[model samples]
Target chain A: MDRNEPLDRVKNRRDSALRALVSGVPYMTWLGVQFDRRGDELTAVLPFDQKLIGNPVLPAIHGGVTAAFLEMTAIVELSWSTMWEDLESGRISPDADVPDSLPRLPKTIDFTIDYLLSGLPRDVYARGRVVRSGRRYASVHVEAWQDNRSKLIAQATAHFLMPRG
Target chain B: MMVGADDAGRDEQARIAQQFIGAIPHARALGMQVEDIGAGKATISMPWAPHLVGDPRRNVIHGGVVSALMDTCCGAAVMAHPERPRSTATIDLRIDYMRAANPGQGITARAECYHITRSVAFLRAVAMDEDGEGPVASATGTFTVER
Candidate 1:
């Protein structure tokens, strides 16, 4: 029994679960969001599209669109992190009977967004960090950037209600 | 630029503002329509769509979509103000979800530009379904005058 082989299997299962979650929400797929997984970190990418532009004068991406992207990123990050934690703690089997619904979707309680700069018409990247997770709620901080990570286009914080398994 | 002070001029300004909002691609994609625009208030409506559902089990619209609707409504309210600048940009927005919206019901958001200074505009909005007594979400935000 190779240790690395088991880890690869788990990764494959997690990836498939993530795909189903994204495709389940039509808006997420419509925005052309793609997830990049690196060990414990997950980043969401929003490909540029002409239809995302809100202000044609400055040709900037819609502020609402950017906020929505950040919100979705936070939820996705929380879902994956929770799933891995459950698997490690033996709370849920990695090979659970459920195929389409491995991770439960969290409900948003509140969301706040700060627009530091206008989002240009280009690929945007976002990463969410779980600030804290309690029995009933989880708080996440997310940052979205286009050209550079340090120079963020927008930052958001959201609190979500975790569903009981 | 100083906004027109006459009735006709104000009407013309409202028309222009409506057109600008209509031209927003994302707004169009969301099926948003300008319900009304006055001095410092604007109302926008989003029709129900199956694709907007966030929770399949409950069939509730995503909170993000509601937030977007409120944000857009607030922006429109600011732009429709009699003392509006040439352009405006969202500085920050805070939204609180009171509860899940009813499935298959259109959401309407009404926003008011309560205060305006030299460089910033303050806005507050409430989103509701058919029942106006209970709000789906409420938002407060500030926009920078880009003139």
Candidate 2:
């Protein structure tokens, strides 16, 4: 079997696993999150929902909701990135029979969010980058924006406990 | 401050705090309830729900849910403060997850606005499930007070 064949197969399985993981979380599903992947980068879209608004006076999305969105994005991005790395390094076999379970979900150790601007009542987009990943830990940076990516509504940094394969 | 004016101010602040919580759609979605509020302090609770679970294998609530709870509690604490502004926005928040919240248990968050300046309020909060001694998470945050 070609080495690339297993990698390709694992990638296909990962997509289905990611979908299951997102649909399993009630809040994420309710947020109407849609994922777009380009290479190693992942973007999460949170469609506008009236129920997400925090301040009716300002008509702004809740800060807590924004934080949660960014945190989830980082976690998902990190999880997928790690899986890719594992496949490349032979840490996980492409033929492993664990079809019903995803790789161990990363546990959040700490997270910091900075609210740069009030989130408007529109679709919000978040992108996550894994700053560093090790056997036991991963650090991710994420930003949420509406209207314009340069004018981010919020930015966050988080550390997660990665599972050693 | 006159005693009568002080009491009235407190009452009005309390009303505003309640209204603020009620107006938040996300809080409503999470079933977050304001349990108590005092000058510079607030307590909020979230009932356990199946949808909030992050790891089904372990039956643990998602960490993001805990972060949202702490953030909301901290905001409420700022609003209940005697020196609270007419409005405020979260400037930043840092949360440390000590452990996963126990499954099938309601979580409560208690927060205090420890300091205030002309333009900012500083707050600290802790979230626990049943056990007040062992916290599921802790947070520190700052909010911008609109003058």
Candidate 3:
């Protein structure tokens, strides 16, 4: 096997694992989470639901719910890579019991949310990009938009501390 | 300076806080129930669920849930005072998860507005999954009151 072969296989398995993970979130399932990956970019599309409505007149999606959606999406994406390494090492399996210390990235060192436009009653999408990934820390940038307008509803740059095993 | 009280203003504060909860479904789904309010302070609680589990084996509530609970409680606590009419934005929230949220437990969020000066409100909350004894998480939140 080529040296890069294991890397490629792990990446592929990561994508599949992400899909299965998103399907498990009941709210994400209700909203229709669409996973789109091209290279290192990950996009999660969440359809709007009436229950997420925060304001009737302005029809803004509740901020907390929107934040939750973004946080979960980012965590799932990060988990894929970490879990793949564990699987390759035979430390964990999809069917096997998850260890007590399930992998954790550094706690969010910080996150800044800039609410540019309010999320309306239409499907919203969040695009996340790994700006930099290192041994002990990783930085991710995420943007939420609608209809390709890039309304820039919320942009978050989070620093995650990677756990040292 | 003498502190003044307005009965109507107090009633309006309660209504606004209630509307805030009514606006968010997940807050409702979490069963976040407000207990009472007094002098720029509020207390709220939410029930724990199997779905709330983060590390399923340990049955801990995800840290994000703890953050959200603290955020909600702090925002309400800040706005509970009659004098602050404008909306507030969370400038920053820092949480320290102390222990795992035991399975089959509910969380109570207790928040108090310690100071309100000019345009900033300082608040703190502890989300207890059992009673008020052992906390699942504790947080300090800062809010900027819109002028």
Candidate 4:
């Protein structure tokens, strides 16, 4: 059901839909996480906050906060991908109202993260790749970096139980 | 077990745990309080807050908050170990979410450093809500122990 609207209008709608979905989660808002959406893809941004410091000696970002950032990125990415499919099939309408139209994200079943380097006290960026998404389950691999994409601060693999359609 | 536990050792453990918690800003922001600490074991609790809610419709606490609590507890356990590791950092952590934490009830995490080598300590932790029969989540992690 690709409506005969201008291409740019449809693209704008998709982008806004993605942002609304991320903002619907209160914890995400509290963490000050923002999404950079281009078309349907996204890169999550976490701004530096003094209150996020875990080790006062090292002045490093809390490992737990990093995990939370990665996990949220994965869930939001998965939700956006599912919504894209639904949009193509006309299963749902473009979200005119924000929170009510936001999709319910999957619940994490398990997450394993390896810290390659200490999370420096700086703004961090993360992206999630959906390894596999099926009717009942999904798996994602996420990477977080500070200055460069090649130099990763942390990476993780997570499995989630998808919400029923 | 009580006969072998010395009063001085217990006092040192509790003091170390408090110091570690006090130094962390996120732990304080979340209002986490250390309940007890004894050689290689630490228990911490956090009160429920509206900002911590993840599933707004169901009013469930966020999974990230649970992981953060467990991570802090595990690190405290390592720092308060009888071996007296001067510093520690999480190298790898694996968390399994067993159930959603009920909102309004507080969450507490207990962690134990079950094993230690020269440079690494192994820890496990469980996060429980006030009314849950079983744990809400469990985590196992490895931390670098700097003597």
TM-scores of all candidate predictions against the true structure: 0.91, 0.88, 0.72, 0.93
Docking class of 2: medium
Residue-level lDDT tens digits of model 4 in A12-92: 767767767766678888989999877677999999998889887778998889988998989888888888977656566
* Candidate 1 chain B weakest ten by summed lDDT: B1-10
Give the clashing pairs for model 3. A106-A161
Worst ten in a row by lDDT for model 3 chain A: A93-102
Residue lDDT tens for model 4, B36-102: 8877888899999888777887788788888788888898888778787878889999999998887
Answer with 2 or 4, whichever has the higher DockQ: 4
Range of the 10 consecutive residues with the lowest summed lDDT in candidate 1 chain A: A92-101
List where candidate 3 sits over 4 angstroms from the true fold. Answer: A1-15, A23-34, A83-117, A129-141, A147-151, A157-165, B1-5, B8-20, B89-92, B117-120, B131-134, B144-147
The residue pairs that clash in candidate 4, if any, are none
Task: List the TM values for chain B, per candidate.
Answer: 0.89, 0.87, 0.83, 0.90
Q: Considering every candidate listed, which one attains the maximal lDDT? A: 4
TM-score of chain B of 2: 0.87
- The better-scoring model by DockQ among 1 and 3 is 1
What tens digits encode model 2's per-residue C-alpha lDDT throughout B25-54?
888888888777778788889998877777
Name the best candidate (by TM-score): 4
On the 0 to 100 scale, the lDDT of residue B55 in model 4 is 81
Error of 3 at B26 (Å): 3.2
Q: What's the candidate order when arranged by decreasing DockQ? A: 4, 1, 2, 3
